[model samples]
Target chain A: MMTKEQILQWLEQFADAIAQNKEYLTQLDAAIGDADHGINMDRGFQKVASQLPKLAEQDISSVLKTVSITLISSVGGASGPLYGTFFLRASTAVAGKQELSNEDLASLLQAGLDGVLQRGKAQLGDKTMIDALSPAVTAFTQAIGQGKTTSEAIQQATAAAEQGMQATIPMLAKKGRASYLGDRSIDHQDPGATSVYLMLKSLSEVLGMTSD
Target chain B: MKKLINQPEDFVRESLIGMAKAHSDLLKVQFEPTFVYRADAPVQGKVALISGGGSGHEPLHAGFVGRGMLDAACPGEVFTSPTPDQMLAAAKQVDGGAGILYIVKNYSGDVMNFEMATELARAEDLRVLSILIDDDVAVKDSLYTQGRRGVGTTVLAEKICGAAAEKGYDLADIADLCRRVNLNGRSMGVALTSCTVPAIMKPTFELDADEIEMGIGIHGEPGRERMTIKSADEITEMLAMSIFEDIVYTRTVREWDESKGGFVDVQLTNPEWEKGDRLLAFVNGMGGTPLAELYIVYRQLADLCAQQGWQIVRNLIGSYITSLDMQGCSITLLRLDDEMIRLWDAPVKTASWRWGS
Candidate 1:
């Protein structure tokens, strides 16, 4: 069973990854965007870390919402709302659960995607964060259906997210500000997809999931 | 890049101080570590209007805060949206019981932050309504596309809407008016060069000297298409015609309709026209472009407008709004009727914008 404490720790780890990789992500954005993707995401995650202690006693859903709201409010750019809505929807979906079952994880992932679709209205193949998230969710759901352990399924999902993130490098952007670049948006790695990879990698570790 | 800023992080802060120093005659500065509001906004009977976004889009959502435009503007870090708490404090300082109107640009961060501000303001029993401006022609079916971004049209819309509010239009009216202006306006932009974001210390995008990007947003985001430089008239034709398609103009007119505020769907379909439509056109500079080039571009745009039978009631050609040192320009056309013309002529003043003396 995954506890609320673990999830919060996972968020911190994800934040740390962003801080460590800030220069890399901003380098990617420098080719196509405003070049603050890493900085903004790092600031938001740091803010989340500061608030995590105050949210320790709260329910997992509430804690997640706090994270969502803080990120959405602090981070500027499309990433803020996209990530914010992801956590908000995920927390709302997993509300009232003290411990999440293997199946509960799938529902949480689904909630996050739904929120992204609602806020970003970005469809699959739009070369957005959805590209990585949808495939990862599918990988997890399929593995769960195969009767694998939750840890194994999440491990599969994390791998899938990493692959999806890498896949964004060659795809042409069809959503957000990058869409305006048309063909030029191609060949550049998506910063959002990169962050999703970081988030999922953190999740795989905290859940102690080593195999699919 | 030879700006007088102390550090990259301190540009917005120092600019706020400069605005206070430069315009002490028109407004007071509130640098409570976040946003700046009008020194006299509270006394202005009409509802307080507020708008903000990432900082690099200079003279926007901030410089336009004064008499007839936004009462206050919250400036975030470079290319970052202000936090909700900052907005909440601004709302309290500017709200005078009449209400508050948030003229939010349709960027994702701006929308979310403004929404949070609305909720926080409501928690304090302040009446707040937000009207999102999505005048960029780049995004389509805005409800379906990644959503329309508020672009050059914001300056024009805010000033006109500001006049209406100053004339005692209520919150609901202000909200609808904001929507109306956004609906009627359409804009397309181009970039001749990329800009360097100070914090990141790199060019936002790479562009060849001869390449010009179409559909460029105010932030240094790449444009819809990159092409070799062409004649000014040819470029103006492309932009003006693109804007013409998005404007849903109609010939249907109501005789002396008092309730509808005298609005008509003025079409710009025919290219071979003597009178296109009454238009408020803007030849907006993209930061590094000079006033002389802007005026020259305006010259071509004016001829194009006339060739299309479009009557130009108002034309603002300058860098009232801009990206940070990006060499480029945009065109905005607001199809107008009698009321719009009257509002266009309304006297207004703000730090970065002014009309009718």
Candidate 2:
């Protein structure tokens, strides 16, 4: 089971990761995009990080909802609505819960992925965040269905997310600003996918440490 | 990297503060969820027109918020799309009771955020409709890409549709007129130098002194191709030729459907330009280029039109829309019909554009 403290730690960890890799993400975006993905994501997550202290007493759902609102209001790009909707749906999937079971975590991941798919209208190979998010959700859900622990399932999810992020390097972009580049967009890893991979990896680390 | 900015984070707000101070008589700026609305807003029984996008394109959405134009304009960070909250707040501030029409440029962030704002506005029981302006011919394929990026034609559409709204056009009628304007307009741009977003503090891209980037958008993003720099005449020919030779471009667009209570896809095809068509020739500077250079481009553009048997009935030659000091220009050719001509020639009083009382 993933406790409420672990959920908070996961967000804090993800925000730190975004901060640490901010320039790296921007460099990746510079290759195919407008080169502000890192800056924009950092701006939103930094706000999210600042709000986490106040959210310490809230239920998981309320905390996630607050994060969603903060991101939607602060991020101000395609990432704003896309990531905001992800957290919004994830919050809905685990409404009123103080913690998450293996199945509940899988549902949260699946719901978040579904929200992104609907919000962004991107498919599996669109060279967007969906590329990393969809595969990670699938792997996590399958592992949970097979009766894996939350930590084990998230580890598999992180592995899948890494592979998915790598796979975006060779794909042609068909969404967002990168889509404007056409053939020139090839060979550049998608910055959105890279961030989503970091999110899953952060969750995995948090759950693994808690389990240990 | 050099810009007159106090802090990267305060760039948008400080600029907006200055704009509000300078144009206090024409428009009012609101903070928190930032938007600029006409000083005397909510003109009863008039369909309100609102438009917004990234903030770097000055005198665009914000500078145009005044009589006979947009009721409000939401400005996002340098090149980022404004949040939905900004749009929703703008709608609420200037609804005018006749309904609201959002003039959204066709960029992914702008599109999604305005879409969400539309839904939110509807939930609040305020009538809202959105029309997209996607006239940039730079993006060649609609099927494979996000369709064409909205560029110069957006300013034209705002002027025309803003007049229509002033003339008491209903929400649906104004929406249709906006769509019609978009269908008749086509644009292409070339960039001579890169621009730096204040937050980024570096040129978005690089080009040697002898090279120019073609088909660039307003946000400093690289365009279709880069090639060795050519003369003013040659560059004008290239840009004008690309727009002139563009075929009947078709794309599926989303607009709010009140009856369906959701968005419905509508397939729109731009009308083909024919010989002897009357055109509104716009030679626009990409911020850094001077007005004198734009006239040079206009000279060639007018000659090219004359050679093709098209008449340049009206022309707007200047940098009304720009990419924040990017050196270059874009050319927009809009075929004008009688109604559109009337709307285009109508009186407009905005901070950036003002003619006739």
Leading candidate by DockQ: 2
Compared with the true structure, what per-residue lDDT tens digits does model 1 show for residues B196-245?
77776667777777788788788887777779988777777788777766
lDDT per model vs. reference: 0.77, 0.91
Q: What DockQ, between 0 and 1, does each candidate earn? A: 0.48, 0.74
lDDT of 1: 0.77
- TM-score between model 1 and native: 0.86
True contacts kept of 2: 0.58
Q: Model 1 has how many clashing residue pairs?
A: 6
Candidate 2's docking class is medium
List model 2 lDDT by residue over A26-135, tens digit each: 87877777778888899999999999999999999999999999998888878989999999999999997877888888888889999988888888888999999999
As a TM-score, model 2 comes out at 0.98
Q: Which residue segments of model 1 deviate by more than 4 Å?
A: A51-62, A92-99, A145-147, A167-172, A209-212, B1-3, B21-33, B119-125, B138-144, B231-234, B244-276, B355-357
